[model samples]
Target: MKKITVKITSILIALAMVFTFVPASVVATEDVTEQTEQQEQVEEVVTEEEVVTEEEVVTEEEVVTEEEVVTEEEVVTEEEATTEEESTETVVFDDINHWAKDQILKMHAKGVVLGDDQGKFNPNNNITRAEFTAMVNRVFGFVAQAELSFTDVQGDEWYAEDLAKAVAAGYIDGYPDGTMLPNNYITRQEAAKIVVEVFGFADMSAVEGNEFADFAYVGEWAQNYVAIAKEKSYVKGYEDGTFKPQSNIRRGETVQMLVNSTGEIITEAGTYTEDFATNVVVRSADVVLEDLTIEGDLYLAPGVGEGEVVLENVVVEGTTFVAANANLAGEFATVVVNAPVAVNIVEQASITNFVVNNKAAGANITAIAAMVFEPKAAVKVNGQDVVAGSKVTVSGGGETVVEPPSSQDPIVEEEHSVYEFSFELPTEIVAEEDVEVAVTFAATEVKDLGYENVRFAFAVATDVEDAEVTFTAVDSEGTEYTFTNEGAWGPAAGFAIPADYTAATDWTLNFSKAGTYTITFQLVTVDGEVLVEGTQEVVVLEEATIVEEHSVYEFSFELPTEIVAEEDVEVAVTFAATEVKDLGYENVRFVFAVATDVEDAEVTFTAVDSEGTEYTFTNEGAWGPAAGFAIPADYTAATDWTLNFSKAGTYTITFQLVTVDGEVLVEGTQEVVVLEEATEEVIEEETTEETTEEV
Candidate 1:
């Protein structure tokens, strides 16, 4: 079943020229970067060499089985049949040789634009602001962020949502008076800003010389944007040296500009050797290539010419586009597709992928020899899959899929599950705010805990005044567990688990007021023994602001960003306030959260008074929240907390000012640099210096 269709022999032996036509003036060239973004690379990593052997044609006995012919109507749904018929219809326009013909037609086929009803694409007509916004919306796949409120734009207007979307995306704006001149033609400078914003190129700061004679006429706000557009070749000056920033852009020129800014064209009849270059567009010409290698993208414009475009020994490194055009009616078949646009990939050619829009146009891709669709690639014709090494013939009528010789293995994906115990809590919260905490108990695989009546408890270690904790709900074994609060608000509360449950459970908690709270959860058996425990920290801020500077409780110090190890460092935390009475609360509790970014670094904090007196700081609270003494109310206080590091690296010590009830009013972090431990020789020298000084 995987063997190549016997047609390969006949196809390789015969090479045909499908048509003959003259060249058109439609020339398009897009840069590699723009096209590459749309392309999905198919990574081909072949570790084992594949062997190919010649196949001998053998005479087979006919089985005499009747062949069945299935009509499209019989197999496809009515809606699908209607859609197919509409997509294959022909699209013809009066303007054929215009420079923007290919771009306009391509966009039309893709339903990005539509010309007038007279089948005439008045390319020279000025494009209105509303029309341009609609086109941008289609081209960039923008959705309505909100309804337009502009006075000139009605709610039911077709372009209203598009205008709103453009504005919401911050790529365009309305006039100062909350009006958007939807009917007025957008000026060149205005369009430049929108284009630059859409492309995210607004930060190009280096200014270039005035590229146009009327540069002085350019507004100050748009000067930088205009310069960048010109510098990137998105816009060009006229022959008179004036940019005409106020000039209205014509429809044809606008299409050309949009296409040129994003893609490239190949008009000359020669091989394109630009490897890895993207956005290569071939339109309205009979082109021949010799050993072409493209790593970006290749676009074939629809109905541009009648001649065959031949690629010899071609290698497509990106997604190749066979049909890239659209019409104004938003119809798939917007252009009148003429003679078959035959793309002959010579024997031994390979394509990473190919895409064809059957609704607008089609291509005849003749694979003289073996053609490969690299692994992970997406190759489709008329919404159908084209197997690799298969000769695909797609016309305006239908598509044909030729089977390949060897079968490809279907890609299989592996799903890996990981176990992690985590909780979601706000890092910072205002004081007196009600907070809900969620904790997740998770495991990678199915597990059963053969236990009954397990007790779950959530505990707070920090002493917080007026703070209340309550268990909200617990979910386990596809059921919810409810617990009642018994006025046991401060320290800990427990919930009873039913029998025969799974390993994971979700717990919800509610807390009142603001404070530095050390939270711990424990899973215990009914026998009062703790099975597992976990801990986390939370800090709360005061809601009210201090009116006077003297009432502000503040802390400040110049903390080093980094340090080397083995070096003696001076560490001090300054505490300041206006007056003794300014300390609004009875006590200003200092809490230290010990943390470090350095691996295996030894850290010790020793509190010292200004008179060289040492005081001990207790870690009475739970881990991550070490409670210190209240600041002396006399006013400005400086407590030197000497920090000692064993290993050289960077570390951070966070200081929190919490209420006696456990609410954190203010907090600050100091980063210290700990260098690599001092070398033995340096340590000996320092020791010798101390001894010599003493003598």
Candidate 2:
């Protein structure tokens, strides 16, 4: 009995040691199994060892139970339980199993929408006007604020700032009663209008016919908006084919509409060819969208950092907001905003209304063509205020300079008298040739006390290189002043005009290349005070049909000084060519033109032959000959042309030889006088009597 009791005590001690060393997590299962087997063995040992006391056994049992309790408690401490719970937590909405569940979840993930404390997305609940505005503001990232005068809105309200942003963005407005019913549920038609305005779809023309059964029930003001939204696929009607315009829009429906409007978020850079049915957000740069259309707005997100996005033959049916620091090229319809970056409107690119938002303060916008701005848009180009709805002309690839509009009641300085200044140019001239320009300066109202020794100055400005201007003026005292200038806006030449003077001067302008040139003239006092100024434009061409002189060849024509009307006269024409080194002339031809006072009269040059082949000439001095008449390199006389005069008037005929390249070789004009038949008869009788007297 003593041995059995000792063995049972040793076994109990071993069991206690095993329980203490085991890990807490495995303690419960292993302890139960080991305790049962030991209990059975202990009972057998206890029966043999009657010396073992019930009190000792009970004490051991209590000790084992306390150890088990401590191990279980350690396995699941307060910190561990909290960590486990957090690991399984997720965003869950119990009521999002509806049609817009995906969209609602998407918006919730973006933190653009939220649920109640119970994690229930009550998508069927009506959305208020203020609530919708907040959603739109978040989507567009609009932070701009506007002054609010709504009677119902308090500055401290939750939606006050968002409503202000929407108003400033020109997408929301208050009622005529000066109250913005922020808490009121927005109807379908009203929501549609807001969506349309937010995307700049207000200018979109409505479809020819409505597809909704309740279309007529839509408010007249919101009808077009609803139609545009539906056409853009931003909104849809119910299953019953009726758009309940007056029905309040639910949260799920609002999310769906917003999602539909912002169709795709393009994050990768590539050339996209697929057309977007709705709005598109470009978050990456170097994206070229070609031959495609975006039915809704296009947003150049801020992620497009200092790169280029080209829109080649791409049409955006809605507004394009350029918020990225990127270069936009190619062609598109209109652009609303370009904040914090320079916008270069390249050549052949046009925009209908380039609205510069307030955020683009001090941003430089360069355009080759004229840009029209919004009426209330406050923007400055080259330190000049851009007037609303006015076209601002910008120089290509240079700083844009805008001229501010003159005030309605401008104060005119009384220091100098107002004068009418005008200049005349040929409007067109040939390059490398000199053309005459006439200028006139006259007072609109002559002052009795005319200022004496008024200085007249002329300046020439051109876009072409190496252009020149030269002229000579003689004053009343016969003092001649000659001046010449080269290049753009060179030094001006000045001369004095007498009092009560209406001065006119002629200047010769020559340009080395084909381009447009401007000649400006000014009348000022001897002290350099400008009285009047004017400018005129002249176009220089590469080739011209009518010119005063020839560089390659010279031509002359001889006709009867006087010929009787209804009679045929012979004209002898000759051409002489000069040697021009390095200029290999080819395909040289002879042509002539005739001008008369008779309207719609046909002048024909016919060779004096039985065939009577008529030569035709174009207004541009191009001719068609019966046979190609190539002019020889030397002085040559080939044709004796006969002309008939139907009317007794002085006629001028121009003869010229031009090359195939439209270069004039020889050009000259001569006049012929035609007498009436009765006058010729009287002259003939007088001539016969004079001859008899001489015999």
Candidate 3:
């Protein structure tokens, strides 16, 4: 925990909620057997807030450089060095502006390490993990390393990979033998050092946070790493600010560290909280990082693939882009990117660290909260560059037409009203650094925070695909937080969601603030227009407080189908109050037939359910439309449960329903079901199924 490399706040975790085709606010946890047929639920009162945010930096295209995509064949092959190659590789080189030649030139051109003809940048030579570890620490601005792992590193043993990644993720420990042989090739042990630094995040947001036992022994070589990490607040220490430096970090520990680093910090190992996260349907190109928590609800869209769903909190770590497609663990949520985070890249993994160049696969704004950082436009902390995939929940958008919020502006105070506004921020900025942002939400007449909804938005450009957009929440103390997410959105569009996992990025973020404060966002564009364009306003009259279970509306409507009955006609009774996002439609029951005969005519149907058993449709429309009340294909031929008109008298069918949250949308009979005639065979079968004949 010395320099901040293994802390949880610096990582991005995976999505917290189990993804489904249901609405974002609620998730369905049941034995869901059906996987086909997507049904749309009508939202009655959803306010389409056009939240367009302006940015502080130049256009995204200018702020970042797009990495040119290359295939394996395009890369310099391992074919034996030609005579011309050796001659080229032997050219004299200089340090400052090395006149690179031969293998060095090939490596440099292919995005590898650099050296010169005179002082040869041995591009074709084998490198060590230890070296990679060291380089990673340097590139990512890991707190200067103060400790070594085993004695071998300190011995005349070289660790190229370890050196690169260690420097990138920011920490390194020597071997049992006491000497760091800078020139010797490294082994797997050396490479793991860097990998562990980027993956061992522990969520530290809770009052009683996680504690590392090695808090006592500060390794002789790892001391510098421990100090800087602790100072930056990325790495935490015991109450005494001491960390266990000599312990060998584990692989799982690596996963844990990297995840915690991106955003959240946990104090306890087995402590888990169950929170409801809502997956919002995005109409805009840019996704606000904060909105998509590591713990989220269900996403109601129908899609597949990585690009279809945008990962909100994924981070990129490492000194170089290794293979361009590697994984990083985040706090509560994690995501995969198509580039190597130069600081977190593993050196020991490859002999020639420059063999493969890494870069992102571009990003798509028309995605599910897609986050993309323009190429090369990364924010730096203490001079160390935050990897390209780090999440920054910037809130500013494009310049707002509304005047900035100032006391001078007309103070439109109301008895109880809701206000709204929109603004923008840049994708690249320093953490814990309060940026001067501007927004103008309407001064609401509603004063209660319970009723008024506050929304924040950011934008991304369509052309910027394969780039990473990050969102992190930093607390006032400069500590980042954690989210528990699966990090996978259903596949539909061009992008494919990575397998669910936990990862993190290097940034200070936290969403657990005590009181009301202003927020900001970064705006992006698609087809040249602002990508996520729109606006809304909110007033934080009070802190965000938890509310009791309740329903906003209690109502019903006529089904979209006809209610008349000659034969067993299908008549649906809608018990939803259009504005219902939850509770308004759940656990309802209804019978189909003439008023009195309703109970006599047995009928059943099948449909998709979203909220699961949390609620049930007793009669019909109980647990939403997908529950049971659907028309059975075998009964009513409009093909389902047919209602037979035996005597053609006044008859009606009724329905009853309720929500798992305890709200009832419908529990009355529609009196709409009228049966005309049952087929002769059906009548005979019914008679035979329930008859006792006399001789």
Winning candidate number (TM-score): 2
Let me know the TM-score candidate 1 reaches against the reference structure: 0.29
Query: What does candidate 1's lDDT look like per residue over 1-695, in tens digits?
Result: 11221222211111000000001000011110111111111211111222112353212121010001112322222212223234323355674333344456655654556665566666545566776666555554444364343445656666666666666445654654435677666667766666665544565673677566887877777777777777655566553456767666556556655553444445444444443233445553456544545544454544234444555555555445444221111111112221224444333433333333222233333434333222122244345555433445433233344444344644333322333346787655566455566676444343333333345555665567767655555343445444432211111223433223334444455556666777776655322355556788877666744443324567776544444455545676786764445444445466775576666666666675556666544322221224435554455667766566777666677787777678887677766666665557767987999999999
| Per-residue lDDT of candidate 3, residues 1-695 (tens digit) | 01111112212211111000000011011111212221112211112231112322223222111111112222232322234434343444332111112223333332223332244433222233332333223222233222222223332333333343342223332321223444344322233223333433211122223333452354433333343334322344322333434322221122222222222211111212222221211111122222223332122111111112222232212221121112222222223232322222121111111111122323211111212232222333223333333432211231112122245643332333333335543332332333333333333343532211111233222222242223344434566543211011111111211222111223222222122233333122110112122332222222333443323432243442323333433333343332333232223333322245444443333333243333322223333343434322121111123233434335445444443444434345544433355457767875886775531
Per-residue CA lDDT of model 2 for 1-695, tens digit only, reads 01111223323321110000000000000000001121224312323333344334322233221111112211212211232223223346775534354556655544457665566766656666767777766665565576664556757876777767766666765664446777766787888888776666677798868657888898888778888877777776654567778776666667767766766656557888877765787766788887887876788755576776767767777678877654455456768665656565665665666677655655555566555454224455545656433345665554565544446643332333457778777757888787776777776675544554345566768766776656555555666666665221111222444335676666666666777777667655432355677877777788886633322566677776567777777888765556533333446666677788866554556554335655533322445443434543444454677776677777788877676666775688888777766566678987999999999
What are the root-mean-square deviations of the candidates from the true structure over C-alphas? 29.2, 31.6, 33.7
Name model 3 segments beyond 4 Å from true: 1-112, 128-130, 134-143, 147-171, 177-181, 188-695
User: What are the lDDT scores of the predictions, listed in order?
Assistant: 0.47, 0.58, 0.28
Model 2's alpha-carbon lDDT is: 0.58
Q: How far does residue 63 in candidate 1 sit from its true spot (Å)?
A: 65
Select the stronger candidate by lDDT from 1 and 2: 2
Model 3 residue 194 lDDT? 35
- In model 1, the runs with Cα more than 4 Å from the true position are 1-91, 264-695
